[model samples]
Target: MADLFDNINDWLMQEALDENPLTSIVETFGRRLVEGGVPVARISIGRSILHPTIGLLDVQWEQDTGQVNTQAVPRQIVRNSLEIFDTPFGELSKGKTDRLFADLRDPDEVARFPMFEQLAARGMTYYAAFSRSFGRTHHLYERISNEFRGASLSFTTKRFSGFSQADLDGLERVLPAFCICLRMDIERFVAGEILETYLGKISGKQVLDGQVERGDGQEIDCAILYSDLRGSVTLSQTLDSTAYLDTVNAYFDCVATAIDEHGGEVLKFIGDGVLAIFPFDEANRPRANMCAAALSSAQEAFARAEHANRGRSGDGLPALHFGVGLHVGTVIYGNVGTARRLDFTATGPAVGLASRCEGMTRELDTPLVATGAFAEHCPRAGADLGQHRLRGFADPIALVSYPLT
Candidate 1:
């Protein structure tokens, strides 16, 4: 039995070193426990993680289905769940105990936690929870006395005989290896999430692949889409700080959501303007996909803006209007700015050209304008605007306007 447990520890360490996902690790651990003659019915691991949008990350392994399910619980939703505050897991989190065990077969003991009663109804006769820190060893005393960074592990068995002392001891012995695997995988998940959130997907992967040095870039052909809200300066002057911020966020939602849904990566929100790109493949059909996606995203943004404006009108607020510019060209997309600070963005003539097209929207009295190149590839006919001299352009720039409706 000792040899079997030691083998499991060795296997878990190897898997951790290999960086297998957390879900895969949990599923394997559950299978191993049942193989070792432990009647494991279900296992769950929960951790409060630092994330931009999620508060709790939990994984569950079910014996019947042999499935591992994972979920990200929103911060507010986790706070509102009263059952968590009443459970033994909550007690462990507050430093009340190193481990908690409940024999669900006993009504009085089950009555102490309502969740245990629910588990008993599901044929779960025994429940055990353990907590271990992922932080510094010197803070071990602080961790036991005060809540710290760690995970809470719980196991439930549906076996009629319930979990024996040996079963419980085996779990305790293997948990150190289990926590180490979880920490390694979770760190990978967190780093990926944070990078993707701060940098757009394409740029985030570039940074992760060691493209952090200043001027590290590549020239890529992409359809650039730039959208800027109209009357933002006036709105900012009229509304209070809170109301103005709400208006800005509402406007951003209309544009950003459309771009995101249509497979464009929003690179930055520059004041009231949003910069996004849909990269073109170098294959035979390059422009069709990128240009079409950009056009669809622009149409969706206009429609969403109309809906948002109607809502604002109902609230007696001014209607919001925005202009979109679409252009397809090659640009150097990579890290820029000083050594202390870096910005991942596209730079070149096309970037400036797209911004110029957006500026033309107000002058032409249209919501969307595309460069001649974008219009040619979009497959949709647009009203051609004759060549006109644009700021900083030596020659006249010809463009096409897309209908707002």
Candidate 2:
């Protein structure tokens, strides 16, 4: 039995080195425990994860078909779930007990936890659980770190012989190693998620791929998009701080969601405006695709603004208005800034042209405007607005305005 445990430890360390997902590690460890002369029919592992999208994760393994199932739960859902406060798993997590063991054959013991009753119905004869630490802390688990964050594991057996003391001891001795391996996987996942959430996908990938130098970047041709909320300064004065912020969020959400849905990455939110891009690869993609995507995104933003305006008007608030600008050209899409703080974004004439087009929206009374470079690729009808001098341009800029649909 000790030799079997030694092999399991070696295999677990290798899994950690390979950087396996936490769910995969938990599933494989449970399967090995059952095969290592332990009468285990079911196993469950739960831990608090530091993630941008989720608060808790639980993994369950079943011996019947040798399958594993994993679940990620939001913090609100976990707090509202009654099982978190009543089940033996809950008790163990709370430190009320370091371990829990119950004979499912006993009706009184089965009544102690709702989960025990279910296990008994599933033909489980014995159940045991233990709590271990992941050696880390998270904000979501701050108040409940003693009851969560570490780790909680449970095992059940349906066999008449049930789990022996040695079986329990073996699992307890190996719990620390298992926790360490799982933490390695989680740390990698968290870093990736945080980077992707804060930085645009392409930039995030480049950084992770070792493009970390201060000036690391490349020039690329792409369609640039700029959206700005009209009359934002006036709105800020008319509404309270909370209402003003909510109004700004509503406008930005419309533009950002549209950009993301159409394969554009929003590089940054410049106050009430958004800067986004759709890269064009002439070798594989047609120029028309980038222009069309930008137009489609503009249309979506208009639709969402209309929807949001109706809601605001119903609540006695002012209606929202915004403008969109699209232009196509090459730009340096890479990191640039101070030595201490760098920003990964695009900077070139195309970016400036998009912003200039957006500025013309209010003057020309058009919600959507595109420069000649962008308009040439868009097949839709547009009213040609004659060349007009814009800020920072040496020559007059030709543009077209799309009618609101």
For each candidate, the alpha-carbon lDDT, in order, equals 0.85, 0.82
Candidate achieving the largest lDDT: 1
How well is each residue in 374-396 modelled by candidate 1, as lDDT tens digits? 98888888999989777988999
Q: Estimate each model's TM-score.
A: 0.91, 0.90
lDDT of 2: 0.82
Give the 10-residue window scoring lowest on summed lDDT in candidate 2. Answer: 138-147
What's model 2's lDDT at 78? Answer: 67
Once fitted onto the true fold, the runs of candidate 1 whose alpha carbons sit more than 4 angstroms away are 135-148, 282-286
Off by over 4 Å in 2: 51-53, 136-147, 281-287, 379-381
What's the residue-level lDDT of 301 in candidate 1? 88
